[model samples]
Target chain A: MTAPEVVSEDPEDTPAVLADEVEHVRKTRPRTNEDDMTLVGSVLGGLATTWLLYERVLPFSGALGFFVSWYLVFLAFYAGLTAVNRPRAVVVDRVMTSLVIAAPSVVGLALASTVVVTLSHGLPALLHVNFYTHDMSGVRPSDPYTTGGALAALVGTLIEVSIAVAIALPLGVITAIYMSEVGGRGARLVRTIIESMTALPSIVAGLFIYSVFIAHFHMPRCGFAAALALAVMGLPIMARASDVVLRVIPGGLREASYALGAGKFQTVWHVVLPTARPGLATALILGIARMVGETSPLLLTSGASSFLNWNPLHNPMNSLPLYIFNAVKSGVPRNEVRGYAAAVVLLLIVLALFLLARLVARGRNRG
Target chain B: MAGSSSLPTRTSLRVVDEVEDVPRRVVARQSTQDLAFTHGVRSVGFLTLVIVSSIGIFLGVQAKPTLQHYGWSFFTEYRWLPNLDTIGIAAAFVGTVEVAIVALAIAFPLSLLSALFVSDWAPAWMRPLLIRLIDLMAAVPGIVFGLWVLLFIQPQATHVAHWLSEYFGWIPLFKVHTDVHYPIWDQAPGFASYEGSAFIAGIAVSMMIFPMATSVMREVFSEAPAGEKEAALALGATRWAMVRTVVLPFGRSGIVGGTMLALGRALGETISVLLIISEAFKIKWNILESGTATISEVIASKYNEATPAQLSALLTAGFVLFLMTLAVNTVAASIVARSRSGAGTEL
Candidate 1:
């Protein structure tokens, strides 16, 4: 076909020729130097402002200063770009409009949370060392001695949590192993039920334990009951964790054991269980961590005692969580101090568990 | 045919000769015994189920008396006075529901947004950091959160209430009496005090619930099919529009599951609510003015001091709470099952 005939039919030739003419005209457009500089300036300005806001050399309120400075810099950048390159104004305006619309909600939440945290915790955390060591005992409401250390409560918490961990770990691990390795249809059903039990509230666990041990069994109000309650609370978590670990073990190992003339029990004990040992440990630790800081179950099952009791069965044991609870509930100033110290301790314990879990997981991954 | 028959006869003769060898029969019997021993290992798995069920049975037996006495009226009655033998769980039920609903209302949206920011909108380097921050928040025990709120948040709440009355007294919720010496007062005109009120409890509960909901939602959001999001974006949709259309639809069931999980956590929370609120069994409608009791808090405060009848009543309440949680979990599991089935078909 001839070039003109290929380009257009007799009816379509006019529009095609006009579109090519318009394209040729547009290609001759020029760029301005000021537009380039404006782009560079905006980029630099955003970076500089972000750096200053984050670096914290100046005594500016962290959240408020960062937000205000970011917006102002962004606004200036958009304005500069618009002034230099009018055609790009639409893009800049759209971006700026959305940011403006969204900024308040984000900034407002950040600011409110920061202010709350500072006012509530920051100042009191700076006050007396008495909050750390003393109990509410002997502290008079009118006297400066109204605040005492949380020593007794801390001891109580340690004993209660320790007892809880002792009960939860073995039960959780064995149950998990059963579900994954030896469980048949009935076993699977049991696992499903246990998984469902994960949704049981802490209080229900407490009430259940209380009714069974304290009311019906006539068990004394002590750390042992609290431990039982927490163990029940931690069971699902431990079972789930152990089950996941067991399932992840390769089937080839089990088959190899059978080929070597090992029995099912022997294979599971020596091969499957060993391979998942790290995860099992992690599960146990997690269970301990979960029950250690639980307050509700402990509150109902383990009556609060002001004095430290090492024996789980003899007397009411104070746990860190219970200590904090009792102190704060009393609405005494000294108790508030003890409460904060206990809180700090409890936080540290949780943090330690988390770190330990991460470490074990990493070791397993590497191994 | 004759040759094949002779071969079969020869093979049988060889097997019979081998069986006749000394120790062959003994080995076969030993193998049978070993198989039985292996089977015994499998039988022990039932012990876990036994332990779990035993707990349930024990609880049921203990709570029998109260359940028998109240029949169904226990749930509907609003009064809870153990000394007067007029105890009912109505006020505790209301407090539990009110606190849970209000906390969820506040935490749900913020958590969704925070999850979105971390999983989708955050810069690459910031994602891990934000995730760790969230994990840290979750790691903090409920007891610590309660202590922080009581010692720190209470004073600020008082000041805020005072400021609100001074500036925004026209608003009903913020009204405060200038003549009152306490920063927060129960009898402030048109305004309720923060002391032992549902509002404080709700905020504390919200703080406790936020980390759980956020972490779950983040995981769910990040797991959403990439193609779905890309397809929405390809249709000239904005980031928010894409999320609204593709991400949210896929995550709806997950969000529901997560919320139910969080509801379980909130329902069981004892120390925080107990420390922050008055253990009063009054069914007050005002969030600010009323001191309300929750099931967990009531049990915690009264379990030691309760008479036999009171203990039975508490056990009944405990049983009800247990059933409520089980019902919630069943619904959640069904929703999850449906979503999985739906995904299977799509695949």
Candidate 2:
């Protein structure tokens, strides 16, 4: 090949000339100030409206005040940003202006509506220390507020969920393994069927269990049957989630394991399963959350009990969902209060599970 | 000649050795069979299929008697009084369909707009906060939403009803009834009671499904390829025009799938409908006037007191609900499959 071509450099070229060109380039670019401001304004306006509405309309003033003050602080920050004329100044200006315009009226309307509702419905019964410690066996609508608590319902819910997890976890995990690791044509067919089952309604699961255990076998409604019904609801979700998590495991890890003379099962257990553990945990917790809030299945299978029933097979179990359903159905003022309390408790339980699952997922992601 | 003779002798010896290895292979196969038998994943998968099938089979068997008695006639008959031996699911079916349609009509546009706001219109800093709020809305239980709407929204709807009558009395839908006993017009003009009406039930169901649809649509819209949007922008399109032409077309199948899934959810929703709809089986076309029962509501309300015939009728209704859900789910799955295949080729 011929020798490489050589080029001569211009002696007049200087660092100052390059710097000036870069600066000129930067100055010619169009600024996004107007676009960002409009966006920020609209967002602030919407949030201010929603926050004001939710707060003033909340059943408790405590939550309302907490949120209102929270939004105002954010509003102030926006105003400060705008005053500083930062790159994001237009965004801040828009937000502050929108909040100033929208917050008062929405908040006022929400507060007015909430007051009317509170007066008509009265305050939800205070859940005292004993509310978590007592059973509802002796409680009546006309009885004093000290009659009993939802301790039994709490215990029953725990037991039902525990048994449901026990049944669902291994089955779901194994099914997922089959779908992701060893799945062939037959496995695909099985997976399709399971996925279809995931969308079956809670009521249908209940009716199926009710017909099988109660009508045909002459069995009484019990916590075990309820747990079984919940397992039906939880299984497909757990299996599908687990399958997705398993499929997402990098192929390199599996190859590394196989190169170490590990068998298929060993590779799956030691390498793949650990990698997907967080997602699996999330799936399990989600299953628990889903079953915990289900009322219809528990209604048909577990029935309802005022008192605690530790024996899953022998007695009707008191669960938060069942308790809420019964209280609402009773249509007594005291019962409605009880319903709200139970609802709050149920919501807390599901929220706790979801948060825990998310934490585990985040931890695994970092690793 | 001596080397050739040695080679033939070695080959004969190797052939003899190969024959001996066959029995050893059979023994190895038996051990592998034992290994496979010990592992339980395959067995567990099989067991799950069996259990799930048994549930469906058991329900079918239990519902067989009702099916045999009514055959195909049960669906068309409207009356549901079992003590008098008159039972049909026609009115309940109509109410169910009507409520689902109306709720979808109300929820679809609202959710689409909300999704657009969250995905495209919101500021970068605000998007996460808005998404979190949407999540909170999704997390609120159906029963809680039903209670809130019943107590809060119903009163406002009544006011709107009165306003419509006062300002636009010529409309048939806004005609006011003056009967004091019925109380359609007796109270404050707008404050009509919806104690057990289809309209209230529809609104409650709409609220229940709105968050799900919005979240799904938001995800689909956000996932649209950036290049397509950029191309539209480069060709001189407004933001709304770009969304209408590029984003919507890309997300149409996804939206349809989401809506169908929501429809399935609405069909099976029991608690909200039970709280809002009336127990009556009568069909009233006027949305603001009266309540009509749905299949889910009827089952929830009457399951405890139902006789064998009535119970069978409910089971039949359950079967119908199952079929409706299956159809919707199948359609959604097919759409999802089609989109996935299309995406694969494009990628």
Candidate 3:
């Protein structure tokens, strides 16, 4: 309403006023009834034409093909319809707007599909009480879904991740502290090394531990070895995250501490770490998230086992990722179902960690 | 560091030292605790450096035997026949690049558009939520993506593959060798040939890396000079035009750096490709055909069944992959670090 009135009164002020006016407007144009009709007509025309091409004129078939052709046709119809009335810039802007909006919609749909497909496929396995309590010790792939569970893999995951957390958390924190608080030539070197370590493939981490621990040292293929591999994978992530967090702490806090005659270590311990506590927790949880879903690192280190194993030493243990990998590729339909079920559990756990990290980080932002 | 900036320089302190009986030095007295702390932290830092270097050293040592045996031919040879004592990373290396290229093709545009949406187009209240959702996507496990692709996407995607091969089959990459000709494209070109192809695997890996690349680009795009954006808009440019003039150019290096980082990740992605691809050891460019191999996938698959000699060969391959990713990541990190958008942003 205001756009046309303003334009009619002072036509030369149109571009500048409209540009400022657009800051308040939600869209480039205040969509009119005619614009709405064009959108609806183009869509309908696109669908009709696509149906004619796919079903009658062209031999194209399949839902994906139909939808894709329809979308392309719809875009064309829209461009043609809009070009008839609007300027070239407006037409291009409108097309780009639709495309920009469509991008996130596609991403959202992909996420929804992954969750929906995983839940739908894994629901049956979750329905069984035995799926949580019992291990797959004697349960064959031929056995019914009620007969076995991922308890062993769960136990192994808990033990391995616990050990990894114990090892990586402190080491990672120390490394971060060393880089940020103890800045020097050595700190720069360590920071560079840590940055590159983030790129180390998870499988290579497992191989490194395998070659060093089992092959060279003649150690057993056990949960402990897997924990070391997980530590290797998690440490760089943890350190890098912590370094960022530590850097974000106000420099004024450290200066105040030093002004009060506090030593470097004192400032770090009493001022810096305390100020960045929630952030450090976020980093730790994010590190754990990275470690939990890792399969390749455990593949070479922790040999798979069917029974529950609590200890990190002496014997083979199975984690959720390895269990899922083995189960899905087992070439059995029943086992494949269980694998999907395990994946659902893993996904839920990771989602939970992500939420926790977000919550903790958000709290720090507010403080 | 804040305190250090305020402290006197060594030359200034030396001038003070030259004045005897006066304050001989301006240097603050180091407490024992501070000295101990410095040493302790430095040693721990060096220990981490040692730990990291040892990985490269260990792989180097393990790869030595294979390097000595196969010489430079190890990288050039495409076949892996342990029995014949002929193994090389050429096929897997090419496949890795092919898969990474395809993933970049799909992921880059989506990430860019979505990143632009999140940074500039999204409502203020919705921005954080969208960012969190992208982060959550990153948090989703790769193996789950493998399962999704295997059970849900692969069957559906084969048709899309057929569509590509039908229309765009003139392009060598889209060309899949099948008896069915172009005119009878509606007739099955054997969807079996399309299953587990590089196209499908790339789609799977693209989903995995999309979040990672988006976050980087979004971070940089959001940091584009707001004043310039408004100036462009005030000069009668549309929002898209403003973005093109200001944000895209500002974030150009960020896009390259982020995409390269994602490419490094795509090259290292193991489980999804391992599941989706049917292993074929040849240098083929037909992405629509049903066979591909990546270095990480080959390592995971062959490590279990490999003999001692074959194990050395696998380690040698791992070394190459490590070096490849290392180089990419180093260059990417340097670019990201040096980019103007990153100057005011936290790393």
Candidate 4:
């Protein structure tokens, strides 16, 4: 938006040439310093309407509904203000501009509210260390919510998710390398299938593992079964995300490695992959994030247990998400309170991972 | 080539003596390491292909019986009673479609606007932050979404549903009931009197889906040909006119593709709906009704408890849901791929 200085036309130039030269002017002009009554009025009016609807008039459904209804009112009010002084086209422009602002507010508010509400409800349970440290084995659901913690569930989630990551990471990243470095019909087919698998539902993934590994084979309802299901969900997502990261690698890096007499596989391994490491990490984070909070898959594959089960293969294990699901459904106030607290912890973890993933993904790009 | 070089004989010794300087053998430059490395990578790639196929095959095999036994009745019959030798997912089919419709109806315009907001209206310093926030929204887990809605939305939305039913009974969709009784297997199945409803579930789903739709639309809007947009604005067209004439048309395919992908996700979503829906069998007209089951919810609820035949039925339902999402994503992916390839050309 920096303004360029005006240059006078050459005095000796012909009119036709001079007129053609003027076409080099900037397409969009900077707004003058004049007062913008339209914006001022729109802001004032939009707020008035929003306050009336959200604060005084409507019994809004929590923050999301309030914001949505408030936004609708804001949009109407802004457009009406602009319509009076502005031409038809300007009105449209103003309205769209206001809407752009409104959209973000609504989305932002909903996200903020989700986190806030979770934390508020979860705070009371978090106040009790037992909620974090104790298992629910001896504590009844009807007992005071402070009686037990999600320690068993937390340990179980780590064990299972670790197993899933162990399985998915190598296979997923290598597959991505294959897709990006080895150009062939097989790679293309793999890419397409991976893309399709990205949409495979979490519940279906659980069902698949449940039927094959648990029911048919009569395998134990342990963390391993859950891990297998989670691995299934994680692999395609990681592979696809890694593939996208690998595709953006500069072609010259590959050629440069080739010129140094590195083989195709060596070029992929030492060069292409190293260049895409940060993005690959992001991909891994994204894949893991998607799987970590998955309740339905774990619900079916890993039978819930109140006692801590360290070994994923030995016995049934509980996960944080499943624990949350169980506690929520128990309909006891304390259990419900415990569920909300677990949810808050889960949210914090997911949010942190999401932020770290973005930072890692962006760090290299910033270069 | 290695062993034969050492055993070479001078059969043409006299002729070879004149051409003595000529080399006896040629060596290929390729190394053993290179061969081993690429082959390993290639195998890993193909393993991906195997894993994908097995899922499809296994699910299909599991679902085969119910599909074969019931034939087309699986899609037409309404009740989900498996104990009396009857299991049908017609209600789930309708409920999924119904909720998805409502979600899309609510989500599309809002998402479209948010996309534009991030792309156009956001201040320069705020754009990156806004985009990151949108992406963060996608990371919120489905279970969390359920928790949010179950606690915060359900209680409040019931009044709205009741009022809508009371005033707008003329409209079939808005028509709600205060009470309904349908006892099945000694359990009260019909539950219009309660808090759980498709409308609330749809809202939760829409929240989950909003980020994706907005980000997609944002990407589309961001790619609108800069030169064309400048031209439109230079012609005294307003910002809205410029966007309408240049951006909207250019991103038409992107919008459709994005919405379809969101719909695909919404249809297969499990935890949120499972936590919210009242889990009834009949296909209800009013989204405000308490008991309505989606295909995904059905699978999650019945996976452990179902009988052998019922398990197969659930698998068939899951298969049907899988096929639907697969079809939707494939179409959307292809459209998105095609549009991406041709994106630069439009400018």
Alpha-carbon TM-score of each model against the true structure:
0.73, 0.76, 0.92, 0.86
DockQ result, candidate 1: 0.27
Write the residue-wise lDDT of candidate 3 on A194-302 in tens digits: 9998888888888888877887688999999999999888888888889888877777777778878788889888998988899799778977987898888898999
lDDT of 2 at A14: 51
Query: What lDDT does candidate 1 reach at residue B41?
Result: 41
lDDT of 1 by residue, B1-347 (tens): 00111112222223456457443232212245445644554454456566666666755776788867876667777777766767788888988887787678867777777777776677799887777667656666776667656655665555444544555666665443344345334345523444767667877787788877877777778878999899977886666667778877888877887787677777767778888887777766555544788887888788878887888788777766777777777776666545443221110
On TM-score, the stronger of 2 and 3 is 3
When 1 and 2 are scored with TM-score, the better candidate is 2
TM-score winner between candidates 3 and 4: 3
Q: What is the clash count of model 3?
A: 0
Q: How many backbone clashes does candidate 2 have?
A: 3
- Top TM-score hit: 3
Go through the candidates in order and give each one's DockQ: 0.27, 0.19, 0.49, 0.36
User: A1-367, model 4: which lDDT tens digit per residue?
Assistant: 4433445466565555556545565676455332265566655776777777677876543554555566666667667766766677776777677766666676677678788888899888899988888999989887876688899999998899999999988899889878876657888888888889888888888988888888788899999999999999888988888888888777766666766767666777798778888978987897788788888899889999999989999889999999999899998988898899999888878888998898897788876
Q: Candidate 2 on B38-136: residue-level lDDT in tens? A: 246777887887776666565566668887787766777777778777777888888888778768886787677667666766779988766655554
Error of 3 at A339 (Å): 0.6
Cα RMSDs of all predictions?
11.9, 10.8, 6.6, 8.5
**Full ranking by lDDT:** 3, 4, 2, 1
Between candidates 1 and 4, the one scoring higher on TM-score is: 4
Worst lDDT window (10 residues) for model 4 chain B? Answer: B1-10
Candidate 1 structure lDDT: 0.68
Regions of candidate 3 where Cα sits further than 4 Å from its true position? A1-30, B2-5, B8-25, B181-189, B340-347
